[model samples]
Target: MTGSSVLSVLCIYVVLTFGSFITVIKSLETQTQSHEHYSYDRVINLPGQPLTPSVSQFSGYITVNKDHGRALFYWFFEAQSHPSKKPLLLWLNGGPGCSSIGYGAAVELGPLKVNKNGGLNFNPHSWNKEANLLFVESPVGVGFSYTNTSSDLDILDDQFVAEDTYNFLVNWLQRYSQWSSHDFYISGESYAGHYVPQLAELIHNRNKDISENPFINLKGFIVGNPETDDSYDYRGILEYAWSHSVIPDEVYDTAKNVCNFENNNWSKECNAAMEIVFDKYKEIDIYNIYAPICLINTTSSVVGSDSHVSSFKRPIRIPAGYDPCYTPYVQEYFNRTDVKKAFHANTSIDYKVCSDHVFNLYNYTISSILPIYTELIKSGLKIWIYSGDADGRVPVIGSRYCIEALGLPLKSPWRSWFHNQQVGGRIVEYEGLTMVTVRGAGHLVPLNKPSEALSLIHSFLSGQPLPKDR
Candidate 1:
């Protein structure tokens, strides 16, 4: 029993410990594989994507209603920094039938922006810098999301959209289980104002019903230039157009007098006046009146049809600051055989920036989400409604008027928020709600003012007041 015997015993113990450690590691790996299978989604690597730091990206469909063959397509980007420690953000783009993946993820807020050359460029101010981002094409007929029951597309309504979105979240969380416990937020722009609040209401109510094993840790939502109320929104638009000098005094006055914005019923005279107003701004981009249009044709055509009146009817020239033509680049990139294969996208359907069929057949039920907002505030969830001051579509004036209607006790008076020593916009806080305005930004705040938009979202997620002084 000398030193040799003790050495032999130590060697045996070390071998046993090392073997057990290897066994444990394998067990964990097996568990992770099983979990991924249950999620039924796949992570993909794109062909032309620039080299990025170690960050995981996933794209695929989550079957919300298997019986109806309803599936929602999603592109998820993990946080650029500490993903596990960051909150999860679900971003939607309103068209009611628009592709969030096309606009929100590709052009506006995701980690990559499509270049004119059909390649990807890293977005320095991507929202994923602050939180994990998930952009979805919702409502079963938008983007890559589809339903087997073709009639299901015809019956699309706000209630159904909200319910399907809720179901998508529930199942999506199951697939990405690690995210189920993280603080969750819903965000979008344009028509998403309707989608975001209504979806939040559903999640809030559903949480109460399933309090025992709540899947969604939904903490709040942020909507940019959302279509909130038809009456107030139209009223604000008219006022904004007049104030911004987009319309002449005579046209404004005549329309203001004849238009019944409250009832949403336009008389013959009012319609005529509106036509004049539209004609006045026909040369300019309605969403961002100040921004240059991307003109593809020489002759002026109607910017949008009656059914899709929000879009520009004519092709205008792309501006220098941001390319309005970016949509076509994204559409082309997504339609590539390799890109679709990499993203696990459905190759059968053609990729479009906006779906006309979904837009035309969509049965819009609610004109305002203020009623839902009232309940959301009572639940003490963080609510933020932001607008791009330059956006003619959903002007800050309308957002301001809508928030003021909430009658929440103001926690902070209106004050300027700064980014990089420059004034970005103004922010005001209430008991449970906040409203922000991005100066010189258009309908898509992040696209026009990326840094300011980044600052805005960082402040929202951190629950800190916007920086008052540069």
Candidate 2:
């Protein structure tokens, strides 16, 4: 061959050789990662926890922003059985600033929960039975998650929260490579109405690039008693209070007329009228209107504190179990030095179920999540919004209004769902969304009615319908 022809042949050979070499290296990397697990974050036992061999637990941090020294903490539980076959569900608790570990894992639906003596007890109805549970303390300042940059807390808002949570998931999946291919779902209650859908939207947008490795298989999201729209939520709170006999008709009427909930301009009369609502909720638990207020617990106030009222419409109240002491028990348990050591939390950091500081500073930018819901419905992701009929804060009345505003065609008419041979609650299906209610349950369904809530989630994840016949 001539000199030019020989040169071209050599160039092609060099390119082919490099390509094969890179492919071999990639194969080796995949094999190595597929077998990799972070043993350091594994939890063999908690300080006062019982020995339950049904599941594996791990707790640790994932740095979302290295430049800011920002990290998010997580408590992950493998499925009760055959974890590999189960879907992965990440649970968040809304406070704009609450510890998912405290509210979600320890108090509500984790395999273990805080008992009266600051010890742990096995919860048979834990949601881990249906999915691999991942509980995250998000947005830097809640629980063990932290940021070295002081100013980071000043700008906490919907956008800031979504980005951090998305980054954590991306990094977390890389570390837990075995779960990278599993179906994923997001769940939470209260302020998470904003968090859950926004994060789902982020995943939906980023996942459009099908070529990306470790693709997030976000199948759907479910939120309980979420804060969807300002006007509807405000209106719901008033109407629910009046309907439930939590407030007098005059107070509700005064606020309804004077409050410009859409514009968020609470005039002096509006403020005074709304203050009566808060003041009345203080008489009983706002989140759980039927539940009595706690007069015995001196170590704690409410679940989310008064900060919740100003930022997110209302606080978590007494966790909906009617015990009023559950929050105090869990609060005391998580703050223990040994318990902190066991959960991979910062021993020096005092873990609050909800942080007053984060709530105070959180820039409440997003007033409504319906737009994102509208967009995600088009993406064909399974979306379910559930309500505890007894939830005074995000009442069923408001949820109905919010759902109605979506303007989706009705897929199923309102009907009673059966569990334990009796009516569990009412359920209705919209074109791409589903709404469920747990009868007599309060703000936190898992805390109030674990069996029904578990059944609700099982139906949601498995693509099955709530049984009308037992």
Candidate 3:
């Protein structure tokens, strides 16, 4: 054991030890990555079920850029039957914070299931019956969508949402190679007026940039009772209530005089007018006049006695100590052993149902997108805006005001249209765009009137002129 030999042997041992450690680390890393990438224990698979229109339902997550860290958004993809080259419809639900999975899944598009207690029956109006529908829980903190770092909680603007959504779409397309060439249309309601338009613009911008994949095709957008122009929406609500006799003429006049409909500022006079309007309408509850009845909670005297089944739909209930609109139940449902396994989310990080403390402001503005809509028109993308007539929040009048403000040329006069002889809805087609009013429907148009909504979507996707009346 000479000194040089002893040193050489020590170096060899150290190298061997480091090499072995590296091998173990790599193995662990590979296993973890595989779990993250290929894990599918959360998604519920309804194999051979006639409920789904397609043979396969794919669920996965896409990594989008978060302000604080990386964010993951869960998406469910339903393929079209027979595999034609059809456009993809991306559905979003509006809440300044709400889960697309909760509303868009349970209420609108995907197959529905009643609660264990048999509260509601399964609905046959799922949008998946028509087109390939992809519902995404957006931003870092919405729905089951979440981010890894604390800074992700700060996103409350259009820019952050659009960026994250764009990233998610791009990455998601790569994950599901079949959809790479599909034309994408963004659709949503309420706050989605903000989400869908901005997202469409971002996709359009990305498509034009030579550096990015030009193949990411963004076609058009549809918003149902969207909160696009707040001024128009609020003012239109008063007008709609007045026209429908929901509010007295005197009250409407008072509100009109005090409220500045053109300005975005909410004044004390406007607040007073709103109070008066609320007082007037408090006695009369009008939501769905032709929908199913919902069970009323024991706390309120207002039992579900309306003839309309859609009116008085129950506000979603969650377990105690959670926000029903955006909370743990939604995330938990999506992360169900069946749901997780089907969606492959169980293998990644634990799902966060709704982003806790994600957004600070309830309202957001996207001044950038108005011009983008014009650009889209110039580029020949057919745009459509539809409002459910019975909705007070974002009424038909508001949509009309917004479209009028755009100064679009009307190709045809506004008139009633019919799906059969039943008078399906109303339509106002102008140039390449169409504005529709869903009859006997409320804010959640698809939930309240799924057939009408689906028909409108089908018409829009086909690039045919919107029918005059339904």
Candidate 4:
């Protein structure tokens, strides 16, 4: 062979050998990752759950306060499809004490639905369709979340709740750092009106102080049927009851006139009027005025509790609709030993849907989250306030009143938004804020109107307007 030809052959051999060396290193690295992917958080299989090969599920604790041994339980479901492309969303349930896993995840928007038979079924409208969903049993003593220091239960307040939640998010990001860059949003309903906004403020404020470690990618928040202002909320409820003929004109007038509706303190007259309102509310589901109140004794066998059976005389019922009593079934499902073990939950503590201790002892530091909302909105966070129109608890009227109080310039006037070629809800947009009312939905909008709820959420995460036509 010629010398030049020999050199060319040597060059070809060197190129091939170097390429093979790089490939081998990459292959070994991939193998190392495959072996090291082991996670204490990895879920093997859930008892009684059907095989879901495509989706990933994780559950366990993130110790937020090590000194107090404070840990929060979390259940996360990767998006049903294209999880990598989806946003990460953390959902909270309000009661200032409700289990997000039990109420928000299982019953409302999670992939699992607690059936009347105490079995699990797929929620066809689960929010995982749009985002990677995480549900935490927040604050100490709620669901599987607990604090070794039992006194942590007694002193729980908005500040503590917000701080703990913020810590959970930050530490959670550290553990699941792959999602640190994903567009993130915090969401909840009811008293989470307090929880969600307060936590968002903390995250936002912390993000601003970049001198300190910041939650750099914190995006925005969405709250539904939130308990924002005691006064506006109460006034809205009274007005809603009268407008819907849920209460008589005289009862409504008394509530409107006698109640301060602007502060936490209530006069005797206000208390009396509220009593009349409560008496009337007993006949129907207060959460969803139009929803069928659960009168069935489904819990006799599984739950072994007669407390769930309503004593109210059955009003003429709608046969085919959302069951207002759906929540009790969820409580029973969570209480099951197998279910708790499968989720890596606190097997020792009996899970209650809403912790009575949390409700009673929880010091509500603020009657209105309006100030927080005002400051956050000014910061240009994507703040969306949505309400289930049929919810009497924190009715649409009240949410609108709170938004109007923000005094933002209107970006979009109130108009009906469509889904599946039908009017799903009405929405109004303002600079850095949007107010929405889901048609026919109750306090739990996703539970009442799942399809519309999914659309609303998909749009929010996509930063697009909700579908306006079929």
Candidate 5:
């Protein structure tokens, strides 16, 4: 070998040796911090709830901004088995203001369900059985996440949410470094379509920029009933409604003529035509047209009142096992002084299923997140979009349109996917994307069809197609 080549080889060896030393030191420091956090955030008891069906869960705040007292709340559950070897999956629920805690954790995929008596029950079908799960109420204005800077609430947008969420993940990883090298996936439903992809793109781009150890090994992302392309979302909403007879044909016809959904602009005629849809939805729960609206009286501030709990009445659909009146119970449970104290949540802050302030002022800056999806897909990120076909709010129709707009080649034709000896749903795979539909499910697929949702998650994480056989 030449003298110069020999010298370069020696330099690389020295750098590698030194890098290993630094990583060891870093690992020790991160582990110490993680241990400290474990003690602080470990959930001792959920009021009136039984022991978790599995390992353990923790909930608390991770300060994203100390200067502004801006902290995001998180509920973390370890995998049921082999947590150290399992992937770390972050779950987000989108209302632009929804609580991942109230919705995703408590009602949807969480192992804990708040009961009618303001108690908690163990959910057997939680996603944690497959992967370590984490849920965050993001952007510092929703759920237990809060900020002292009131002005921060006013400027909430997609970029703001993504940046804050990213900050939380980085800090959180350092505090739980054992999972730093594990595969990580972000999944959510509803408005999270925007939140999920936007955050994944940010992380993917940031990972490319990062040359050091603080990298999040983001494997893929999945979103259900997501609000993707605004144009497509609107079109899908109208089409799904009309096809399902939620609105009259004449009204749908008028809307098509007057509304420029492609650009999200509407005329006076368009507004009037669309009102028919809003009016019709009032007669039904728009999220799940077939699901009954919550008839229980939650109007009174009487917290935990059993007065509204009526005699046993079977739910319209038994498969989902979600109550229309459930959110109120969640509200009652989380808002309790004892529960907040146990959760390490701020007693002063009022918990909400969705923050109207954040929702109203949430500056939705993007017209379409399809561009972000295309970029991530090309970057080789596994992308999947699952839709609860019955969700009128963000139906499968919009998701299909959004996927088609990407112009990816079909990898597989649509086929039935089974769960519990029945056809659970359908899946259509693309070159780098997969579209899934949960039959008879609404906005929250996991809540409506837990078994099917669990089955879908299993397939996605394993990088396998949904089971074709029994």
Candidate 6:
């Protein structure tokens, strides 16, 4: 009744506790397997429209079905000349609804720029110079990216963009089987801060399914002047304007005192504060070497002669004859027999240059994907975020706020990385992640300072420390 009874009771309690724990563990494993097996019913891939003049060059396009309807994406792929080994870089341009083709082709990675005759000019700094670059006109109506059916902006959220992009990649690799062995990386700017991470998460999730999917080897990601967080991004804009003396001190103080950065909703106070700042800084030219008025009339013609143009100090435009540097020109380009033959979009009716106008009409907010950063780190993918110091839109301070939110442990002291004996940027290494700031660049890092951006990207891809040429 004493020692034996007490020992029997203790043993029974231990058995019950262990059984409960095992049941809970088994339940969790079953749920995990269920989620793994859950098939996404909406993913549908269309035919691959490959571009030519092959010669191990950059070119391709693929049709895909989005929530709105059938859409087209013009892609540019750069193949390694040596033929054996090369990485694939998927580049996206951000506007919540902008064209990657406009940004990638006219501005950043692609070799061609829109000439004054509404033609293509070859660019030497194209990302194709290093890795195979792929650009997509994403979120439907951004550029050459368009939907067949007329609807109210069907695919506007982050999830839809990620899913559609993943499906497109799978079908694309199927068409170009050679890309199956290539390593992959996702790079972009502006809203691409959101696009890149979402796509990266999708790739990581899909990799768990197919054993040989080439998209699985997604090595890393690079974002320039990324819009990661809205609260800090807007606040940072004011801080940047104030610091650069773009806004009066009084206006900056009024903004700080009246506006609530946390509530992104438009307020009279916020508007008034912004108005005051804009009124003061309206005449200050921050982007170019010229006066502020020049920045406003971004599309104005160059005043000097062709010889002077050679040494012109004006802000870069998308050449002449084409639309504004940032405007969509897919419809304009594809409508031409030459561009149609180049892209193989001949059969399509009335090509739409701007797809987002038709596909992403509703306002879509992207705020929760920040948690995906953890998923990327857990999967051993390197992530790098950089900001061009002079860009007021998505300033360096915004990046600092985003990095702080990551809660990463610093691995090295922050220092400048250089190129050609100049301070190109500063680097911060933390827990295998890298965040840097380009010294004299703007919203478009590659366009404003291609060499510096390329060097940073090359270093990240190779898993090397940022270059120090000081």
Q: Which stretches of candidate 3 lie over 4 Å from their true place?
A: 1-55, 113-123, 279-295, 298-356, 359-363, 367-369, 465-470
User: Which tens-of-lDDT digit does each residue in 1-470 have in candidate 5?
Assistant: 99999999999999999999999998888777789898888987777878545448888888888888899999999998999989999999887677888888989898887788889888889999889999999868899999999999888888999999999999888777778899999999777888899999888878876776368899899999888887888788889999999998888898888877775555667666666766676576777878877666652211211211221010011112246778778888999999999999999988888676776677767879999988899989888999888887778898899999999999999998888888888889999999989999988888889989998999899877788967
**Residues 208-241 of candidate 6: C-alpha lDDT, one tens digit per residue:** 8775654457888988877777777777877988
Whole-model lDDT values for every prediction: 0.81, 0.85, 0.63, 0.79, 0.82, 0.63
Ranking by lDDT: 2, 5, 1, 4, 6, 3
Which portions of model 4 show Cα errors greater than 4 Å? 1-38, 297-321
Worst 10 residues of 6 by lDDT: 312-321
- Taking the tens digit of each residue's C-alpha lDDT, what string does model 3 give over 107-168? 56665532333222345666666667788887666655666776555546778778877888
Residue-level lDDT of model 4, residues 1-470, one tens digit each, is: 99999999999999999999999998778656534432667667665555653457788888899999999999898898888888899999877667888778878899877787878777789999999999998888888899999898888999999999988888777667677789899999888888999998998888877788655576899999888887787788788888989999888877788877675666777777776776676677777778766677642111211211221111111111267566667777888898877777778888887676776667767778899988998888898989888877678998888888888899988888998888998989999899888999988888889998998998888888986665
How big is the positional error of residue 359 in model 5, measured in Å on the Cα after superposition? 1.0
Model number with the top TM-score: 2
lDDT of 1: 0.81
TM-score per candidate = 0.88, 0.93, 0.76, 0.86, 0.89, 0.75
Candidate 1 Cα RMSD (Å): 8.3
Displacement of residue 156 (Cα, Å) in model 1 is: 0.6
What does the lDDT read for residue 385 in candidate 3? 87
- Model 6 alpha-carbon miss at residue 448, Å: 0.8
* Winner on TM-score (2 vs 5): 2
Model 5 TM: 0.89
Q: Candidate 3: deviation at residue 156, Å?
A: 1.6
Candidate 2 structure quality by residue, lDDT tens digits, 400-468: 999999999999999999899988999999999999999988888898888998999899988888898
Better of 1 and 6 by TM-score: 1
lDDT (Cα, 0-100) at 249 in candidate 2:
84
Q: What is the overall TM-score of model 6 with all chains considered together?
A: 0.75
